[model samples]
Target: MMTTMIRVVLPAHLRTLARVESEVRLDVPLDAEGRLTQRAILDALEARYPMLRGTIRDHVTQQRRSFLRFFACAEDLSLEPPDAPLPDAVASGAEPFFVVGAIAGG
Candidate 1:
């Protein structure tokens, strides 16, 4: 069965590191009931953007790496877990998923 598509936007440094110019799009891995989860979305995103390998998660711990953020529907998802469910708009392809590198300074 076909599923909806989600657009993932990456930060500039990540884009340069990944050597990708356009936004990354993925198919929501839907279940029998058509429910889509963040884990599924992230898995697909990582698979498609191999250069983004450790940019979001720690290569050793598999934990969320520092300086990365996830956003959708104007909500900041920097601290959200990998398995957290996203908004319906994002899951249903009405909105795009964002993975941005956090800025730091003092």
Candidate 2:
């Protein structure tokens, strides 16, 4: 199995929960087809920071939380499928995957 070092930037609240002050670095394993997806990243993240399990995604369904959004290379990836491959920049650690807290209506 091939692994890639992915850089993930978490929101302040989640950073506090995970006791991390800056961006997180995770070693994520690529799928059989050599694809690096959000699921792979999140799985590695949760495994390293168990406290963030339900904060980013539902514990049971493993779905993204409604109040959060995903972005990479200035593009919104929240609507993308979990199994979809991420941008090469993200996979190559050139760009960080951002987990931003969504802002709501006033």
Per-residue lDDT of 21 in model 2: 85
How big is the positional error of residue 75 in model 2, measured in Å on the Cα after superposition? 0.6
| lDDT per residue (tens digit) for residues 3-77 in model 2 | 999899999988999999899999999999888899999999999999999999999998899999999999999
Model 2 TM-score relative to the real fold: 0.95
C-alpha RMSD of candidate 2: 1.4
lDDT of 1 at 68: 76
Q: Give each model a TM-score.
A: 0.81, 0.95
Candidate 1's residue-wise lDDT over 1-106, tens digit each?
A: 6477887888888778877786777886765567666667767877877877777888778777777777889999767776666788887778888887668872
Best by lDDT: 2
What candidate 1 gets wrong by more than 4 Å, as runs, is: 31-33
